[model samples]
Target: MASSYVEELLRQLAEERERADRERERANREREHADRAERKLAEEREHAEQKLAEEREHAEQMLAEERERANRAEAKQAPTTLEQYLRLIQQRLVTTLLVESNPVNSASGSVTAVNEKFYPLELCRWDDFEKQLERTFIEISSVFSSRSLFPSETDILGVQRELSPTSRKDEQDIRPFVRSAIEKPAERIVRAYYDLTNRPEKFCFQNNAYSLEYRDPETEIERRSPSKRRSPERKKSQPIPDRWGICEEEGGLRRVCVGEYKAAHKVPDEEIRQVLDTASKNLFLEVLWRKQSGTTNSEQDKAKELVAQILCQAFHYMIQSGLLFGYITSGRTLILLRVDEFAQQRQARESEAQYAPATQLATFALLALRAREMPRDWIVQAENCGIYQWPLVPNPALHQNISLQPQTYGGETSESSGENDDPNDSDYGASQRQSRSQPDQQSRSQNERRRSPRKRTERSVGEYCTQACLLGLVQKSPLDVSCPNFSMHKRSSARGKHPITKDDLCCLLRKQLDRSLDQSCECLDRKGFFGDVGVLFKVTLTEYGYTFVAKGVQKANERDLAHEMKVYSHLVPLQGKNIPVCLGSIALTRPYPLVSMAKVTKMLLMSWAGTSLCYNTWPEGVDIKKETDKTLQTLAQSGVRHDDIRQSNLVWNAERQRVMAIDLQQATITSVTKRQASPPVLHTRKHRKIARSSSHIKGIVI
Candidate 1:
């Protein structure tokens, strides 16, 4: 029995060993299969990466080749004609600036975020815009000898492609790219107009984007009405527009036209379309979304907010800047806009005129399109089907620009504008002078005729929607007038016609004591300028047709006005020629429109001094620096040593055709001094230094 047990035990052990061997063999086979799968995956991943890299390289190479081809073609063609060159430039810009081959339709989707200030604007579309200014723009450009209007293709491509891959993906900093792409093209093209039409006035472009465009507009209306209240928070460091159409004038580099640009991604084609009235046949139109229905359609509200966001900024900017032609664009669509001064004024008088009665601080913000304290929906058209025509595009004929003097990039030469005038233009220029003879008649006719009712429409951008339209505005140059509207010679030549004595001035306030001040005088500018202690207004006395800038201050700030008065009194001899002629101050019987804060009771009238000097270069035969220096030197000799000497102080007096130092409110009287209209030079046997200086001598005893 013991022997049998041992044999069984050995057999059991043998069986156990065999079972272990079989398990080991199975585990080894499984390991081998797993390793094989792992190797295959690694090999496949490596192969895929290599293929992707190759594809990327090929795409880059092909793009480079295409760019080379485009460059070669541009150079080889050398399109000499202005139209041809412009077309080529437009094509290249289209290729560069417009990146969306097929933008997403956003009209039905999420709205873009922007600070919204809802305002009503009467938009007028220029139906025959092609005929408004010297027929077709092509013809206007044709008059210019085609010099190199286009930047070199290589340079253009390089600037256009400056966008980094990260920036393209991020899309936050797209304005620079858009500006770089179009600024040079539009500017170079416009140069021909100035060179050909206003010869000796060099055409240039200024990036006033970073410049101080205007002071913070008084936004009291926002506080008064909850419906019109919008967050006034905005970028404080920069100006509104991205680009400026500047030309060298005697006063400074004049801001002719301005443009507001947006990132294509931020302001998509669909959003622009959403704002436009597509039901009509016109190419351009204006939209003002007024009144909010409590019935909220999230989609429509988003659109309304978006449209207001995009337009309110630029609309207010153009209004304040006083420009004949201005535009807003996102690479996909361009909308040309013109401000009808009379129409805009009428609208204000009829609609938002209540705030300007001057019951508070001179907080005059441009609430032009906005409705405060009113039942909503005044700007929007309810088609009776609960369908809202949100953005109204105005189709008004592009009228000739009047006069505006914009502050230059340096803030040294900031020329304010007259109603419907260009910033660089003074109302006393060629246009103003020609119309001066019949000033009352012309103004009356304009004031009587309201803006055409044909202005607003629910229309598609149509033909003007193309990027080519961006280039088309290049021809809307205000080249018909002299480069510097009221420079030295022009002012001196027209001196006889202007008011000499205070009584000679055509003052509406004095003539119409029975009527309200607002009714009697025409407000050339609502928010013209903010002085140290007083607000400056461009006004036309309606009764006798006296146009002068009124320096107004509230009753509280009369002390500062006294100091300014003293300075003017000291420099009395330099009045009307070297300095602005002071028309005596008047206490207001009633509040004025747009500028009456706590009833601006005192107004010191003075001839319009052209804006400050900013440009190093002036129009041919003009030396602004020399002229201004002489004026300052003369001021120093006249007991009044103008302590403040800067470009801003040196005002270019267009009426007198001289650059005189202004803003003497901060000036000091250094000593008791005396001067003469024409000091009798003592001509002795030996010629005195003063006698030898050939010219009509007008200064202190030398």
Candidate 2:
């Protein structure tokens, strides 16, 4: 029983060990599967996160596109009403102010000024105050916009705020209300100023003004007597026009009688003051009118007349006030009155003057008139006329140049006229004498014409030709030489056959020589006529019927005349030889000119022989014939080769009587390499034979 129990225990132990091993193997497999699952899940999570990010990016891009579209749509909308445009104007004004202030004050100062001055004014109704504000705003806005004060992304409103009154506080503080009201109009006024004052002759307000004494026409009175004038009677008193009453007060003297009683035209000091005060506006209008009319002399004249009238009215006012009588000396008043009357008369005359001849006069008259009506226009017109227009009031410069007297007005004028007489008397007398001599000179011219008779018949050719020929002869002769007896010569020529004169020969030779020289020089200078002996021979033979040749007179005999040709054949062609051809044994009467043996010998022995000797004696390497032949052969080959060829070794064999090339012993053989197979050897002997027969043959021992 014990043996059986032990055996059972062993079996149980074996069974338990096997089961535990199996369970351990199963757990190991489970962990490997879990690891694979975790890796897969992580990859999936990563992909999902990437997808979410891409979707978010797409949504943001869509939103951005929507915003851009909205901005473009808004930009297209227009603002029509004043109220609707107020915001835009305000914004623009602010921007302008800021830009202008950038070079001056801080941005904040500009913003503050715009806000205080422009914003409120723009919101208000369009009145003078608002208009002025608008003008200022426009100017400020323009300045800022021009400077690109706002970023591209920023709207106009944003730019305005950026460059508002805050940017320039100091400027905004002084006359704050006026500044605000005039800001818009200030721009208009500034633009007007630029336009008006653009030229050197422009009428500028700062340069011109109505005199303090100048009065309105409504306030001016006519003076019948010099002093202690009585009031005009009711019948004589002129009623003030209604238009004049608009700005004038008429309550000085009740009445003044004319003729029997002393009638003084009166302009109270107050009226003068009023006119002077209004002159600025009136002057501006006048300038505007002149500008509109395009500144013609007529317009200028009209402006001057208006100015003079205005000044005269002002002066009259001063006279009535007794200011001219008390403060101004009589002499000065008289001068002023004279200048005034002169200006008035000029204006009246210019108005009646025609356009053509009176342009300058009208211009001056207009300028003078402008001085009174529109002080600014007057100054500008005077400047345009090249005159210095100064203020009529007390100025140091004027005082230095002008005389001031204190006698009665009319008496002072008389005294000044007497003072001016002495210097001008002699000049006046001289001018009178000159004027009286004019008629006598005219009578003398008439008498001279009457004494000389005129010819009506046509001039004869002989007479005309004789005179022309005589004049030409005189010109050609020395100044010291007396004029030849042309009359006697003319009579002799008419009595005989018209001789071929020296002049006729000279004229013919001049034309022939000029044409021949021109042709010869052109051929020599341009056509390479002397480059080759062949070309030289051809040109000489064709042009001058002369050619170079080396030939024996008889077979086996030395060359009698190697180079010879007739000097003249059908035509005389230009030859290139240094010496002209000698005409020998060549009958001019013959149909075909024949050259003589002696002449041929001389030409050949002289020029052609010299040329051959020089060619033979040339340095070995300097042989042009050999060099030229080598050059031609090398050019014919299809490989790299040297071009150092020349004529020294080349020779003309007397036996062959043809040029030949020599000295090929130092010639380099240019071998062409081939990709597929060795290139075929060129048969140079065959080419040489052909080339020998060709123009570039090498040397043959003569």
Candidate 3:
């Protein structure tokens, strides 16, 4: 029994040892599974952190790029020097003048004069204001004196001093038909005219418009009559109008201003309006009326007619070519007209009683140069470039330095393209050669044909390469020397399979000009590039003859070229007559090859015409002035405004006696007037919020 019990104990001990082993194995398996899950979770967390870091970096990069773009835009939109100055004056000077001065009531004949008491002048440094005015006048005078401001001294087209008594005159009878009722004579002046003609001699003095000669009706009739042919003896007796009116030289009437002469008493509002209307609008009529005096009429009627005639004649002289100013006066009262069209428009608007009060004292005094005839005080004031001060109310003669050249370019034929072995040939000499070249449309392919790119895309890379080379050429060229004309062919490399590179296109343009790597063309406007847009150069071309080249490889320049081309296309018909004729244009398919640059470039070829007005004199034909005025009127009718209408832009062709316009880059074309005017735009609340947000983003206060 002892042996059996021992055996049973051994078996039980064996079973207990096996159960302990199984439990150890199960715990090891659970621990291994848990360790694997923990490792996987840790790996996932690290991956998620890396992705978040990358996303944050990308967002920051995007924000930086957007900020840079905004900065660039702001730089471009910044105001130019002249524009900034104008804004400053508008904000400060204009506001100050308006505050300190009283409203000029035309009826009361009260005018605001910026004298010693002018608060703005007293508050600020007089020297600074004077300096600004000097600069302003210099610019204005340079522009004005440069071009043909009036008909040449030799122009003889004359309006009859007296119209036929029996003729029924109407608006159509006016030389330049009054555009609107706004340009009518004042009723007060017209009524006053029914009562008086003081002696024109009273108003006539040296350098005054009143000194203009009066054409006698009887004499004019007698001379013009078919039966009144004059022999040598009779011819000597018949009066001939002086070539330069009453003045001995070219500029007899240097400046023209208007004035209303009242009897120093307070005029009625109706009379004042009538006077202004007459002075502004109807004064020109007196030029047409043949009768200045009535011999059979009573003294009152005779006086009335004479006064009207003399005033009209004086006004006519003031509006003549080379007019420095326009003004209206009534005894001590004075009002000056603004120079530019925009300023003039505003002045006109304010003149009407219906508009705002005459608070524009600064505009008249500083801008229009209006003041009392305090000659002694004026002398004291005009010391340092003071004679060239604001309004520069010019006297009859400033200077006689005529800069107009006789030839466009010297002695070279268009066939030669103004190219010569002589290095002394100037830009003017080349342009003279251009005057004889073929008319517009000489290059049909250049103007009309479009070339397909070797590799098709939005734009071709080959063209871009070509433009880059051209710009490089312009930068290195001179404007005063003549360039050789050479032929350029699209020749391939020895391999005959290589694509055209930037170097190749440049070489092609160089060859066309016969210009080697060391040689360059001449710049016309100036010797170097003034800005990023482009440089103006005198180029002799084999295909287009002598041409003025404007090349712009920068994006801004490209935009300017595009705008000019658009304007050129519109005025193509008037080319060589009143505008620069666009000969052709060139563009590279891609942006110029410059560092950090990815924009297209373009070049324009225009007919080499006359120099700017500064270098030329006014044509001596009244017809030309009339034509120019007509052109302005036509432009206005078309809803187009020549915003940059100034002397520099007016190019005068002495040979053809033509006045052509250049630089229409700042022109604007307005939308046509609606037959049924559209209701004013009203923004919804959501739109207003969006607008406010956009303005804020643009750094503009709405």
Largest TM-score belongs to which candidate?
1
Q: What is the TM-score (0 to 1) of candidate 3?
A: 0.22
Model 1 clash count equals 35
Number of backbone collisions per candidate? 35, 74, 48
Residue 312 miss distance in model 2 (angstroms): 16
Global Cα lDDT for candidate 3: 0.31
State which candidate has the highest lDDT: 1
Instruction: List residue ranges in candidate 3 displaced over 4 A.
Output: 1-520, 525-534, 542-546, 551-553, 588-601, 621-627, 634-639, 671-702
Cα error, residue 589 of model 2, in Å, equals: 99
Give the candidates in order of TM-score, highest first.
1, 3, 2
Worst 10 residues of 1 by lDDT: 357-366
Deviation (Å) of 238 in candidate 3: 69
Cα lDDT listed for each candidate = 0.41, 0.24, 0.31
Task: Summarize candidate 3's per-residue lDDT along 1-702 as a digit string, tens digits.
Answer: 999999998898888888778877888888888887888888888888888889999999999999998876664454323223223322322222111112252133222211111010000001122233334434433433333222211121121113222221221222121100111112111111222322111111122221212233344455557997656554322111111111111111111123223222332222332222222222212211213222324432333233333232222222222121233332122333321111111111211111111111112222222111111111122222212211122232422221211111122222333222111100110000001121221112321212311111111111011211222232222221121211121132223222233234333444553321111333221122222234443444322222234343344444556666665555544544455445445554332221111122445555444545553466554465565566666656655567766555555654346666656656765634333222111100000101111111211000
Q: By lDDT, highest first, what's the ranking? A: 1, 3, 2
**lDDT per residue as tens, model 2, 1-702:** 899899898898888888888887888788878888888898899899999999999999999999999976664343222222333433344223221224334223111101111000000011122222234334434443333221122343443444435322332232222122212222222333233334112111111011111222222322322654445442232211101000000111100000000000111122222222223212322332444445625533343333323333323222221111001010001011211111111111221112111111112221221221111112122222311112222224422432221122212232333323321011110000111112121123423323321110111111112222322232232111121334333343434322233244224323432233211111110111111111111111112111222111111111111112211111111111111111221111111100100001111100121122223644455555554455345433523232323442233432223333322222343553333221111101000111111122221100
